[model samples]
Target: MTIFLALVVGGLFGFVLDRIGVTNPSIMGRMHALMNLAVMKTILLAIGVGSILMFGGQMVGLVDVGHMSVKTAYIGVFVGGLLLGTGWAVSGYCPGTGLSSAAGGRRDALYFIAGGLLGAAAYMVTYPSVKAMGLLEKIGGGKVTIGTVPGSGYDGLTGLPGDVLGIVLGLVFVVVAFALPERPRKGEPVPVAAE
Candidate 1:
């Protein structure tokens, strides 16, 4: 049932990405160039809505806090994020969008997926050596959340209530998304997929 639900959700997500033009490399490239903000607005809206619902649920005791997983922070995490951003900008495909793009019949997205797989394999093969170099060492015990979790020592940097903080930040994102101009600037070329 869980797998079935995941497939349905994944399909829906892909459909949304496709409909929003995120499956196109040209659109993504223009987003990176700041020539387009549709993708950014969409992402911000998602984040805002998700954060609000998640934190609101927690506040109402409707969500299971125990099920939440927060990744440990470390140098490698930052380094990995930088690499991921670089890959996204260069290849014009993040993992999720890349998969969706490939599913939508983009040949270049397939190559992106192949390169990602190779990169993952290389990382796995070099894990031991990387660990030995202290790349995986936990800094300050690593695991943390933006807000205080019951029975956990980590209260993040601000030591604020997580749910409240999440809601505030989420609303901020929502506002920013709405504030962005939808139309391209004068003289800006509209992005289009190449034939």
Candidate 2:
């Protein structure tokens, strides 16, 4: 049921992305140029809310902190995140969002889609080799998350009580977002609906 609901919600979001014509490179480019903070704003809100809810659940013991925790080691994770960030900055879209945009008649998005597909295929083709040869063996205890408390024994770095911090960050995000200037490109019709 949870998985089903997630799929349904994800589909709705994709539909919304499509309807807003966010699949266009120009739209994304223009957004990066200053007329939009849709991606950042959306992500930060999700993170902020998610952090608050997770901590709240844990504090009230509604969720199990032990069974639902993750390990945190940052080497591969940091590298992977760096790569993802680089890709997004270069192409102006993440994989899922890029797919949505390509569907909206953006030609560059096609290349992006192709590149992603090829990358996936290559990974699939190499998975056996990666595992059989133990390529990722060095990434010990790979399932890390912020909540995944480890042997450090909560020496003040525990983020569980950080819901207030998340809320404060969220509020700051909202305020700073409002202060940003919006400038539309020359010759393109302004997105009146977005205002």
TM-score against native, each model: 0.86, 0.57
Model 2 ranges off by over 4 Å: 19-21, 33-73, 105-107, 123-156, 183-195
**Model 1, TM vs. native:** 0.86
For each candidate, how many residue pairs have backbone atoms clashing (under 3 Å)? 0, 3
Model 1 lDDT tens row, 1-195? 999999999888888889988889888887887787888899899999988998888788888766677788888998889999898999899998899999989999999999989999999999999889887887755887776755345557557887788899999999999998765563577546669
Give the range where candidate 1 is weakest over 10 consecutive residues by summed lDDT. Answer: 149-158
- What pairs collide in candidate 2? 23-101, 70-148, 71-144
